[model samples]
Target chain A: MRAVAVGQAELKLFWRNRTALFNSLLMPLLLVPVLIAVDASGVPLVIGLVGFALLMAVYYNLVTTFVARREELVLKRLRVGELTDPEILVGAALPSVVIALGQMVLYCLVVAVVTGVDLPSRPWFLLLGVLGGVAIFVLLAAASSAFTRTVEMAQVTSLPILMACLFGSGMMFPLTNLPEVLAKVLQYLPLTPVLQLLNAAWADGPVIKPLTVVAVWIVLGTYAVQKWFRWDPRR
Target chain B: MTAIEVRGLTRRYSGGFEAVRGVSFEVERGEMFALLGTNGAGKTSTVEVVEGLSRPAEGTVRVLGHDPFAERAQVRPRMGVMLQEGGFPPDLTAFEAARMWAGTLTSPRPVDEALEMVDLTHRATVRVKQLSGGERRRLDLALALLGKPEVLFLDEPTTGLDPESRRNTWELIRALLREGVTVLLTTHYLEEAQALADRLAIMHRGRIVAQGTVSEVVDAYPSRISFVPPAGVTLPFVVDAEPSGRVTLRTNSLQSSLHELLAWAHLNNVELSGLDARSASLEEAFLAIAEEAA
Candidate 1:
């Protein structure tokens, strides 16, 4: 309940920041449609782009919310109350995480209906990918804010994943396209395995290949990000 | 009984800064205790540890008989804290924020009642972002009171408040005390401390210089009577007489001392000027102590 309350409060603030919402939602509309022009024929292209939009609308935007709260000393203030550390953090992350989940579902629906993007062979693989991708990225975003000096720095701090998921989160090119060695390396990048799991699930490819790989990234990414997260803004 | 008992509390930051070096104090139940200190004097560090937001680098802090760091769950639900910076989310209406906090407590005061206590019922629907600085502080205090907490920690609660707002906050706190709520407030405003605290501890650097009732602590210093001297009309030798003005003398005694000086002065050539006597207040005592510590 505490976590829900915190998340709900964060969600309200997230909606109120008009510029952030416009950029996270509408700005992507213009570019994604244009970007989707090149490979409208392939279902993988649409799935990948939808994944990118989820990361944009949900994952990336949530980072700024937590970053702004920490900068404002909201997290520190919340800590002084009855809330435990986990309660405070989980509550803070809940709103964005829920939004990310909703956006992913919406994106999946939009692609399936409009572009006739087919369903995944292994539904569990895509489900794991969606949940795991959000989990890993939320932690990574928090960890990223430790280095971010201000909310403005959130844009720059998030660029690495923004670009990586573009080329690496498996939302852009399939890891299979690169040289065997490089493909294997890119497959292990933070979003690579999750995106691949999603892609594999969507295409009904052998589920085991992406599932085993994606699971490792999720576990490893979640561990690394939580261990390194800094809730207090240094000023 | 002690509502707050801190023993050898120490807080050493990661950058080799020992902000609080073994500081400790106690606040009796239902007493208004003030933690008085200047900026960067380890006050914030010590208070954070007490609020259970940070662990002490050494020693123990117990609020209402529960260790704040080790037994946070026990202390947390029973206490309310208002930190240096107000923490209410800006988008929520004041009423919503109060109600949300009320949901977290085991035995909370009604949301409307808490708002009414702070005189913020009129602004219940106002968005937190829309509130003025003083209104926001009242809201922060309102949230702290939502739980009807037994122990309330207010750090600089009146920092940005106007005189009227500060007085209102003082009255609200006084009412809480009347209802037997234990308050631990930190403020640099000596008058605020003097007005509210039944007992207070003055901090210099990371150590307490004095701790007691205001009258007891302030009366530890010298009381003085200052009056214009009757030229060449002083009788009886005075111990610590400071006469700097053209004809002014500050003496340790007010009654008998004033009478003797006046009688002698009347027989002589000068008339006593602007006679006034005062005991050192907590403010005077605090400034004197801080200067010496500096």
Candidate 2:
């Protein structure tokens, strides 16, 4: 209940900053046009764009958010209240999670309309993948923030993961386009299974293997967050 | 009931720096206890331990009969803390931030009332980054008071406040004190300590050099009486007799010193001009302690 209140506040603040809102809310939407320009059909491109939005929502947005709040002592102040460490972290991530999910829905609708493609054959797979991606990336963002010493340093520390997911996770390009050996290896990166799950939902492909891969990443991400998440800023 | 107790509290950082060394004190319910110290005097460290923000290396700390660190849930809800620096979200409006903070506590006072308590109702919609330093301090106070906490910890609560705002904060704290709220405040302003603290402790070099009522600490230092005697009149009770017809007297008792000087003037039909007798003030005692520590 308290986490919901905190999340609401975070969401309000998230929108109030026009620059942040532009980056988090509108940046991915801007990418949709670029993807369409590159791929005239744009169906697979739209799916990749949605995955890219999820990456920003949980990884880029949340890493900087946690780092900025910690540097400002906001996280330390919240810890003094009834909220536990995990409560504060999860609550802080809630705003970005919601925004990312909303963006994904909007993207799917736009893709369906633009490409004249039908809706997903299985909606449950897509829903599970989206939520599971949010969960895993939220934890990874927090775990990444522990090593981020300052708000300025967040930009530097968050870049490697951003590049890795964009290039390796089928965000900017489809995994099928890669060499057989490269695709096999990239398939195990943190965000690969989520994107694969989304593709499976759209194309009526197998779900269990991708689902298992996402579950494993979720466990590893949760463990990383629990082990290294710093409630206070690095001193 | 004792609201806070620290016994043999010692806090050492990783680099062999002992911020607090065997410091102990208690704050009673309905009382205001100030902790005064110079920079690096361990005042904030001691307060942090009491607030359960940090643990003591070797000692016991209890707030309302519960170990603050071991039983944080029981003690934290009942206490309010104003950190040395305001930690509010910069993008949040003052009103929005206060409302959100209030929601984190149990049965918090109305957000509007808390803002009004700190005289911040007028700046309700202003973002925290736009607020002046004094306004930000008030915002910190507003959040601290939102919970209507039983014990309040204010670390230099009025550092950046102007004179009027400082007095207003003091009034707010006094009103809470009247309602039996225990306050443990650290301040560089000696006058603030003198005005608000029922009892205080002066810490130096991680140790408390003095702890008592304001008057008791002040009285530990000698008072001074200086006067220019009438021509050809012998000085009485003179601690120092200057050759320029000026006499300086030192005594622990100010009242008797004044009385004897007046009697001496009357007996000789001579006037004692420029008579100035003053007991030590808290500021004086504070400086004396600091000087001794140096």
Candidate 3:
């Protein structure tokens, strides 16, 4: 119940900032027209767009959010109340998660209408992929904030994961197109299984491997958050 | 009953700097205890531990009979903390921030009442970034009071307020004390401590140099009597003469010393120009401790 209040406040703040609103809600849509203009296939395009939305709306956005709140001492002040550390984090990440989920639905509808692609044949996989992706990315963003000293530094510190997800996680291009050895290694990247699960929802593909991968990443992400996530700014 | 207790509480930074060293004090219910100190004397560090913001490196602290750090869930709802800096999101209006804070408490007062307590109701719509420094401090107090906490921890709560606002805050705090709220305050302004704290501890270099009622602490230091020495007239007692021809005397018994000087002057028919006799103030005791530590 308290987490919901914190989320409501965070959502209000999210709306007041025009830049964040644009980045979370509008930036992902900008890629939609481009993919459509290029006449990309339905399944791959939807998968790539989902990956991009999760990356921007959850990961990068939360990195800045955590860093800024820490530096501003908002996290410290909130801790003085009844809110636990986990409650504070989950609450802060609520708005971004909601936005990402909303974006995924909007993207699916747009792709389905324009490209004449069928909606998800297995909607459960899509739901799992979206929910799992949000959780992992939120954890990853918080862990990244440990090294991020300032909101401005988030741009620099968040680059490596952003690049890995873009090029190595099969978000931009399918890992199957690369050598088998490279594809096998790239499948372990955080975003790969998420894209795979999204693909599994729309087309007939192996679900167990991607599901296990998603579960493993969630575990790893949770561990990383436990080990390194900092609630207070460095003195 | 004791509302807060600390024994040999020590806090160390990551770099091994001991900010608070074996500090101990007790605050009774319905009483105010001020922690007064020089800059970097660990007043804030000590208060943070009691607020359950951090754990002590050594010793133990209890708030209302529970270890604050370990039993935070039980104690937090009953205590309010106004940090040195509010650190509220700059984008939030004063009212929005109060309402948001109120949401976290189990039972909170009306947001408008909290704001009005700090005289911040008029500024409720202004963004925090646009508020003045004093206004921000008041907002911090408002949020702290939202839960109607039993124990209040104020770390320099009025640091940036104007004189009028500071007085208003004091009145508000006094009202809380009347209603049986326990207050633990830290402040650089000694007069604030003198005015508000029923008892206080003066800390220097991470240690409490003096702990007592305001007069008790002030009494430890000597009172002063100063005036220009009458030309070519010997004084009744020894005096330290300044270069400007003014002589001064420090004494524990201010009344006796002043009476003696007046008697000697009357007998000699010599005028003691610029005569002034005053007891030591908290500022004097505070500065003396700082100087002794140095």
Candidate 4:
């Protein structure tokens, strides 16, 4: 309940900053639409939308929240209170995670209505994919934040992961079309299991092989968070 | 029970530079105690250990009779802290931050009440980023005052305040002290220590060099009179003559010293330049101790 209240205020603050809202939302709406127009087959369209969710919900939210808090020293201050260490971190991230979740839902709904695509058949895989994606990105963001000395550094810090996800996550090209060696290598990338799970979950028969891979990635991401997340401003 | 007790509290950074050198002190309940030092004196490190923010590498710290590091929850709800870093979330409004802090405590003062206490009620709606430096300090104070904390840890709470704001904060602190709140304050400002602290410790080179009641420590040093002996003539008392040609008399009795000086000066038919009598001030004791430690 407390996290939700904080999340609501965070969302309001995000909205108040018009330019941040534009950067966070515009990339998805415009990029996905352009991809849909180019393909016209709609398969690439849905994949592009899912990719957008991963970027904003998990990657962007995580990085921005981490950098902002670090610069402000908010995490250090929160540690002195009654809140436990985990609670302090998780609570601060809750707001961004919630925003990410809301954006994903809204994106999916908009894509469905405009493109005439139905909801996923199995839904469980997509559900797990989105939730697991959120967890993965949130953790990765914290890990990435360790390298980020300042909020101005966040843009550069986030670029590598963004580029890696764009090419390696099979959003630009179908995973089945990739060379077997490359496909196997990319399988370990954090976004691969998420996209694979979403794709499998959306298919008529429902493939669940991505479940194990995603679970492993979740563990890896969480380990990184535990090991590298910095609570204090170094300077 | 001691509000705070530290034993061999030392903190060494990862680079092997020791910040706090096994310093320890106990803050009795319901009194204002200050840790005095210039910047980089490790006063912050000592207090942060007591506040349960940093784990001292070698020492043990107890607040309310529970180890702060091992038993954070046990001490957290009972104490309030304003750290050296005024780390406020930029997105948080003053009221929201206060309310969120209030939620953390099992028992807390109402958010508005805390704000009102710090004179931040008018600016409660403003986002933290919009606040002035001193306003942010008040917001920090408001957070520290939440839970009507039994013990408060304040690390340079008046750093950026104007004189009016500083005086107001002092008055507010006095009110809290009257209500029996145990306060532990840290500051570089000497006047702040004299005005508010009943007891204080001065730290230098990561160790406390002096700790006692204001008068107790000062009384240990001789009260002094600084003056230029008129016409370079000798005075009755033994004087520590300075390079500046000003004579300092280290007298045990201030009243008798003053009496003797006035009588002698009248009989000698000379008036001294810049005659100033000082009963051993806390500032003098602070300088002496810090200089000795350094």
Candidate 5:
């Protein structure tokens, strides 16, 4: 209940910042046109857009949000209240999660209209992939914020993951296009399983292997956040 | 009943720097206790421990009979804290910030009432980043009061306020005290402590060097009498003289010392120039502690 309150305030603040809003909401849409121009179609194109939305709106935005709140001492002040550490974090992340999910929905609709593709055969897998991706990315963002000393440093600290997910997670290009050995290696990257789950939503593919991978990343991400997330600003 | 208790509380940072060392004090229910200290005196560190923001490195702190750090949920709802710095989100308006904070409390006062208490109703629509420093401080106070907490912890609550706002804040605090709220305040303002604290502990270099009522702390230091001595006239009592030919006498007995000096001037038919005598004040005592620690 308290988390909802925190989330409401965060949503207001999120909307108030024009630059952040533009970056999170509009910037990722630009990639949709580029993907279309590159002749990417069907499940891969929709999955790519979903991955971009999560990365830009949820992961990147959350990293900066956490770092800025810590430096501003917002997290410290909130701790003085009844909210626990997890409650505070979840509440703060609520706006970005909602935004990313909204973007995912919009992207799916746009792709469906543009490509004249039918609805997914297994919508459950799509839902699971999207929800699981949100949880994993939220935790990863919090954990990444541990290394980010300032809001400016967020750009630097978030780069490695952003690059890894972009190039290796089958977001920009499909794994099938790469060599067999390299494709197998890249499949284990954090976002790859989420993409695999997403692809399975539209067509038949292996589920248990990708499901196990997603579960493993979620566990590791949760552990990392618990172990390293900082509430106070580093002096 | 004791509202707060600390025993041998020590706090150390990651690099082994002890910010607060072996400090202990208690405040009874419906009483105000101030922690006075110089910069780097560990007052904030000690208060943070009691507020359950951090665990003590060496001792225990219990607020309202519960370990504040270990059992925060039991204690936090009953206490309010105004940190030394306002950590409000800059993008939030004063009203929005207060409303949001109120949402987190189990039974918060109305947002309008909190804003009115801090005289921030006029600035409710202004973003925090746009507010003046004093306004920001008042907003911090407003949020702290939203929870209607039983025990309030204020760390330098009036640091950046204008004189009028400072006085108004004092009145608000006094009103809270009158209503039986327990307050634990940490401040660099000696006069504020003297005015508000029922009892205070003076800390220097991470330890309490003195703890007593205001008069008691002031009484520890001697009163002063200073004047320019008439040339070649040996004074009746020993004194410390500066190069400017001014002599100062420190004495616990202010009346007797002044009388003795007046008598000597009359007997010698000598006139004393620039004569000044005053009893010790909290400021004097505070400066003395800082010097002694130095």
Candidate 6:
């Protein structure tokens, strides 16, 4: 209940800043069309775009927000309350996760209509991918924030995962089109399994490997958060 | 009942610097206890331990009969903390921030009431980033008050405020004190300590150098009685007589020194002009201690 209140307040604050609102909404809205234009098909493009949106909204956005809040002492103030450590992190991440999920659904509908792609054959697989992706990215954001000292440093620290996901997660190009060795390597990146699961759901392909890889990422991400998460600003 | 108790509290940083070294003090219920100190004097470190934000390297801290660190859940709900620096998110308006803070507590006062108490109702809609420094301090105060806490910790609450705003804050704190709130505050402003603190401890170099009521602390130093006696009148109790026809006397008891000088003047039918008698001020005492520590 307290987490919901904190999340609502965080959402209000996020939307009030017009620049942040524009960036969060516009990037996904514009990126989906660009991906469709490049691929000339909607299914794979929509999946990649959904993954991309999750990365921006859940991972990058939250990493910066957590860093900024910690530097500003907002996290410290919240810690003084009855709110537990997990409650504070999960609560702050709630708004971004909701935004990403909403954007994913909106993009899927738009892409399906524009490119005449059929609905997913296995919607449950897509749901698993989206939910798992959001959870993984949120945990990664908290883990990343542990190392970020300031908002400026957040920008630099977020780049590696972001760039890795952009290329290796099959957002820009399909993993199958790459060399065999490269495809195998890129498939192990954090967002790869999520994107593959989403694409498989769209195309009715096999889901076993992608599901297993995503579950592995979730476990790894959870462990990272537990090990490295910092609630206070570095002195 | 004691509101706060610290025994041999010490905090040492990783780089071999000890910020607080075996400092101890107690604040009784309904009392205003101030911690006055210079920069890096361990006032903040001590308060942070008492607030349960940090653990003491050694010793114990109890707030309202519970160990603040080991038993924060029992104490935090009834305690309020106002840090010396940024704690509010800069993007939120004052009303939104206060409302959010109110949501965290069990039985918070109304957000509007808290805002009005800090004289921030007019700025309630203003973003924290846009508010002036004094307004920001007021917002911090409002959040601390939102929980309706019984024990309040204010760290330099009026540091950024102008004279008028500072006095307004003092008035609000005084009102809370009247309602039996236990306040523990740290400040570099000696006047503020003297004005609000029922009893205070002055810390220097990680230890308290003076602790008592304002008058008691000031009384530990000598009082001065300076005057120029009439011509041909040798005044008693004159410790120093300069060639410029000025006589100055240092006394532990200003009243007795004044009486002896007046009696001597009356007996000789001579008048003493330009008489001045006053004990040391808190500022003087603080400066003396700080210099001694240095």
Provide the RMSD of all predictions against the true structure, rounded to 1 decimal: 2.7, 3.2, 1.5, 2.3, 1.6, 3.0
Best by TM-score: 3
Per-residue accuracy of model 2 over B1-294 as CA lDDT, tens digit each: 899999999999879899999999999998999999899999998998988877899999999999988899888889898988647789999998888898788879999999999999999999999999999999999888888899999999998899999999999999999999999999999999999999999999899999999998888998988888767666554355688877877788889868877887888787778878888889889999999989
| Model 1 per-residue lDDT at A7 | 68
Lowest lDDT 10-residue stretch of candidate 3 chain B? B230-239
Off by over 4 Å in 3: A33-39
**Candidate 6 global TM-score:** 0.90
Per-prediction share of native contacts kept: 0.48, 0.52, 0.68, 0.61, 0.77, 0.65
Residue B83's C-alpha lDDT in candidate 3?
Answer: 89
Clashing pairs in 4: none
Per-prediction TM-score = 0.92, 0.89, 0.97, 0.93, 0.96, 0.90
Worst 10 residues of 2 chain A by lDDT: A37-46
Interface RMSD of 2: 1.3
Error of 2 at B152 (Å): 1.4
Model 4, range B109-186, lDDT digits (tens) per residue? 889999998899999999998999999999999998887789999999999999999999999999999999999999
Cα lDDT of all candidates, in order?
0.76, 0.85, 0.90, 0.80, 0.91, 0.86
**lDDT digits (tens) for residues A1-235 of candidate 6:** 7787789888987887665577679877677567766673678778877888888888988998898788888998888776777888888998988988888888778878878888788888889989889988998999999989887787799999999998787788777889999999998888988887887786766688888888898899989988888877887
Rank the models by DockQ, top first.
Answer: 5, 3, 6, 1, 4, 2
Scoring model 5 with DockQ, what do you get?
Answer: 0.81
Clashes of each: 1, 0, 0, 0, 0, 0
Lowest-scoring 10 consecutive residues by lDDT in candidate 5 chain B? Answer: B231-240
Per-residue lDDT tens digits of candidate 2, residues A25-91?
A: 8788777766666563545765676678777776888988898888888887887676666778878
How would you encode candidate 1's per-residue C-alpha lDDT over B1-294 as one tens digit per residue?
Answer: 999999998888888788898887889999999989888887777888998877888988888888787888888888998988856777788998787677666678889998998889999999988989888889889889877789999999998898988999999899899999999999999999999999999898988888899987887776666665645654455534455643334445556766776676666656657777677778879988989899
* Candidate 4 docking band: medium
Interface Cα RMSD for all candidates? 1.8, 1.3, 1.0, 2.3, 0.9, 1.4
Ranking by TM-score: 3, 5, 4, 1, 6, 2
The candidates' DockQ values read 0.59, 0.55, 0.78, 0.59, 0.81, 0.61
**What tens-digit string does per-residue lDDT give for candidate 3 at A133-234?**
888899999999999999889889999999999889876666778999999999888898888888889888888998899899899999999999887889
> Candidate 1: where is the Cα deviation over 4 Å?
A40-42, A203-228, B230-256, B266-270
